[model samples]
Target: MQSQWGIMHGTHTTPVGRVRDGALDLLKWLALLSMVLDHLRYVGLSLDGLYVPGRLAFPWFCLAIAANLHRTRNAVVTGHWRYLGWLLLFSVISEVPYRMFIDDADTLNVLPTLALGLLVARGWQQKALIDRGLALIALILGAVFSSQLMFGFFGVLLPLAMLLVFRRPWYFSVLPGWVCVAANQWQILLNSGSVVALTGLVACLIAPLAGLMLLQYAKNVSPPAMRRWAYALYPLHFLLLLLLRKALA
Candidate 1:
């Protein structure tokens, strides 16, 4: 059977079967909300504690990418280019607000890391020369921008790792979990007093498997509306947070 996007579903199961899992959508929004809360700590409050909740964002996003990959299995390889294009566009658009909101933040921002992650995942999925080239570019950019973000080069690699172990047994995800933890410098930090940090570290380790399992079991979700205003949400939310912070300050 085929869904509205003309992609096959309920047939030819991959590691995870084809389905429109609502839980994945729920996870994405939850992750997005958690990320916003984490950013709010920098903008309005010193709730460094909120960082734990924020940890959900990246992994959930990675899972979303995996879900998209499963859904678009039939699309031409070029279909992924459009997805990367949207991510790149958002990354550029969100740069100013991201920098403005987070003190001492590098301008490249999270979207670039995600874009690179997509390239790596697609390259691994399709094994194309262009995809491999794009992944290389992402890696180079991550290296160049490493000083700005704590996660740096490892962040770019996290999604690919997630894709690699996707849908395997829970224990199998540990390899990527270790990589995710290392990517975020989990062991190096000594935030012993901060439950947020500890929780975030643990979540980072488990998010891939959790996300994969969720997508594997659930179904009946709709894609987000693609109105132009929808894309503005990324930057606009930051502006709103900035304004809220200023008012409270």
Candidate 2:
């Protein structure tokens, strides 16, 4: 855990030679922006169009987690636990605001889904007994309570699948994209000819590939590194948005 704590700090303050990943920072910012815009739809305005961009939020976030995990391959054991702890803590803290702001939340907050995704991703990467055991536990829980999770079974699997093809060819992302669509419970619409179906498929496929492009080609463009403090924004944004709703009323 001391090692992870060092990582927690090293993320914000790195050595001179440790060049920060600008594109990764950009993707994190993008995820945060998409989340805010998506929630704006509920602010009682004609913001339905925000939904499409909002759909970009989760997949990018999942990729960011996977990418970070990959970069710190040495710290998977400690890092994942620390990561899971933060997500679980915020999952509890954010639920009230999430439920308050959304009003139609039928499931737990997104953190639990992300937490389980972390476990799944790690399990796939390592064959250790502890890793597989924990992954199996999360799998059963995620499965039995599918409807109660933010994205359900496939959602829990999306991060693991994305981790599998993280730096592979862009075309490979389509595999996890399918998993994403399934996670969203919109697989039935995949073969349909509707506008929403196309939008869903496009967002699923593009979100991850776009993040990969940022990672591979946007190296020179420096973006602010997203650190631990960013987690505060999740619940804080809910309160801010809630205040906006009050003002609007």
Candidate 3:
């Protein structure tokens, strides 16, 4: 049945032998690093140059979502729900810290956008009616609240775009690569005319493909597993950074 869906949907959902892929762990760790680096700019440091690497964070995170969904396409229904529940839970738990650390935050923390992206990607990968309906609702909400979404509607679409090109050739990843740029607000970056902003624009453009290469060729490279508890890191990092900012002040 799963194979049938794979064929009909033109997805590479073949179940693998391993319980976890190390490449994915590596990707997660790198994404975490990129995120931390990005947030460091807010940590009372004059590290505006970090913005270029920070541009890599969101797309890499989205690629992680797509990679996980692609690999676990055959997992039990409850597992999928559990995955989403964790994101939703952390979205709420992380918001206060996110707002605290990010000065004048206009949007919610990045988790809510990731949660919606997950639903949209799952809708594309799963044949279940519930999945499709949830994706539709996610899309509507993303559209209605795009201004409130961290990366806006393009960010919501990024996971699905990554999933679409997950198993395809590396060139195919350019689709999501462009989406990553848009999600990062390439226009504003371009118009800024700063060297750092332009560098960030280029980083966003290639972040997805860079991540895909890591996933494809780095399977043997082991890293720590990024489990459900890792969700806490999202909020905890903000608190730690906020404290650092206070100390620096």
lDDT of all predictions: 0.69, 0.79, 0.86
The best candidate by lDDT is: 3
lDDT tens per residue, model 2, 1-249: 111111222343232324467877898899999999989988888887777788789998888888777666655267667888999899999999899998888999898999998898888777899989988988888899999999898889888877877545557777888787777657565666577667866787677667666666676777788877889999999999999988998
Using all chains and alpha carbons, the TM-scores for the candidates as numbered come to 0.82, 0.87, 0.92
Q: Residue 99: error of model 1 in Å?
A: 1.5
On lDDT, who's better, 2 or 3?
3
List the candidate numbers ranked by lDDT, top first. Answer: 3, 2, 1
Backbone steric clashes in candidate 3, count = 0
lDDT of 3 by residue, 1-249 (tens): 111122114345455435788988899999999999999999887999999998888998998888778777775567778889999999999999999898899999999999999999999899889999999999999999999999999999999999988556567777998888888878888899999999998898888878877776687887888887899999999999999999999
lDDT (C-alpha) at residue 24 in model 1: 63
Clashes of each: 0, 0, 0
Candidate 3's displacement at residue 17, Å, is: 9.2
**Candidate 1 lDDT over residue span 1-249, tens digit each:** 111111223355453333445666676776678778878887656688787767767777776776677666655556677778888899889899887887677446777778877777776777668867877777777788765644677877777777666544556667767777777767655456466778888888887666665665554566562333555777888889989988999
List RMSD in Å for every model shown: 5.3, 6.5, 4.3
Error of 1 at 41 (Å): 0.8
